[model samples]
Target: MSALPASRDDASPLSARAGLRVALPIVVLIAAIVAWDLVVRLNQIPPYVLPGPLLVASTLIQDWPVLFGSLLTTLWTTLEGFVAAAVGGIALALLFNQSRLLEYSLFPYAVVLQVTPVIAIAPLLLIYLPQETAVIVCAWIVAFFPVLSNTTLGLNSVDRNLTGLFRLYGASRWQTLLRLKLPAALPYILGGLRIAGGLSLIGAVVAEIAAGSAGAGSGLAYRIAESGYRLNIPRMFAALLLLSTAGIVIYLLLALLSHLLLRRWHESALGKDN
Candidate 1:
């Protein structure tokens, strides 16, 4: 009887906390929107200066066709960059894992790429490369280091005992890498991919903004810049809303993929229920 009550009590609190986690953000968002509406109305803020949320929403609906097209362009660039980053980073990390000499020589350059701001690099890329290629390159630059570093760390972090056991069994280097290191490093690789997904989007946006000045692109970031020049405040906010939604969607999709892939074996995915 006591055990039954204790279980019920524990489960009830966990459920309530889970509900609160979901509800609280929604409540806060609604309250913030209300406050924004009231402030705008009371202050008589001109729509040109700061259009209310409702106007932004209406503008989004009104401009859906154009905004959607630009969004697609940006998404395409982000996708290209993300794929490139994932492939190159993982491949280089694998190479580094195999060769200490390569790791020593190339790791510093990877660090330099990461430390150097993509925004500064974008203008030069735009000058030398086509606008689309430049935008994708910028996204790749911003995203590549995270995957390389994380994967390198993961590969190097294999348990010494397990490694010794493999060696004891006379496992070939390829067999040990394929059977042991890759599986051990999966969580770290997923974490890096999650980070890279958002960063690729950001890199594309930055590059598009740099490209916008020359009237060269139709990406969402370019739309935002165009709206700014025209003082179409509602349109700017609407474009921003769409861009933010895209980013959130990208992050959620990657997180869901991570959870799905890791749920069966990984602690990080397994602990969610508790």
Candidate 2:
């Protein structure tokens, strides 16, 4: 009877946990927005300098059509950049894992590239490539490093004992890697991807900002730049809000994906056991 009740208690849904998880952030956000509104009103801050929360919200609604289109454009660019980074990073990490010489020869260049700012490179990319191509490349540059480094770390962190056990059982290299190492690395890889998702959006925004100044862009960042030039402060705020929301959505989606894929076995994903 005690066991039954204990099991029943454990079996209770995680919905309560989930609700608390969501509600706390919503509450804090509401409080922050309210405070922001008060500050603007109390200080008599000019809209051109900093629009209040209500004005920003109103602008978002009023300017949704143009803002929405720009939002889609930016999102598409981010998705493309993210896909490219994921593929290139994972594939290169695999190659580096397989060969020490290759790793030594190429890894420093990767670090150097990462350290170099994408904004500095954007103008040159625009000159050499088309505007759209330059923007996508900028997005890829900033998003690539975290995935590459994380995946490489994961690939190298496999248990030595399990490796030796596999060798003792006469498993082939590929078999050992596929069966044991990759499984262990899945968590790290997913974590890298989550970081990459937000980074890809940031890259897209920065590149778009550079492109917007050059006068050939249509993304949300471009809209912001255009708005600034026109003194359309409300529209600028609306576009900025959309960009921020898109970034949050990207992070949440990646986090949800990581959780779904890891929940059954990984420690990070497993809630209090039911």
The prediction achieving the highest lDDT against the true structure is: 1
Native-referenced Cα lDDT, model 2: 0.88
**Model 2: lowest-lDDT 10 consecutive positions:** 1-10
- How many clashes in each candidate? 0, 0
What TM-score does each of the candidates earn? 0.94, 0.89
Runs with alpha carbons beyond 4 Å of true place in candidate 1 = 1-11, 272-274
Summarize candidate 2's per-residue lDDT along 1-274 as a digit string, tens digits. 2322233665544555566679989999999999999999999999998899889889999888889999999999999999999988888888899899999999999999899988898878878998887878888888888899999999899988988999999999799778987788889888889999999999999989887767468899999999999888988988988899899999999999999999898889865664
TM-score of 1: 0.94
- Candidate 2, clashing residue pairs? none
Instruction: Tell me the tens digit of each residue's lDDT in model 1 across 1-274.
Output: 2323344544775666667789989999999999999989999999999999899999999999999999999999999999999999999999999999999999999999999999999999999998889999999999999999999999989999999999999999999999999999999999999999999999999999999869479999999999999999999999999999999999999999999999998899976556
Best model number under TM-score: 1
Location of the lowest summed lDDT over 10 successive residues in candidate 1: 1-10
lDDT of each: 0.93, 0.88
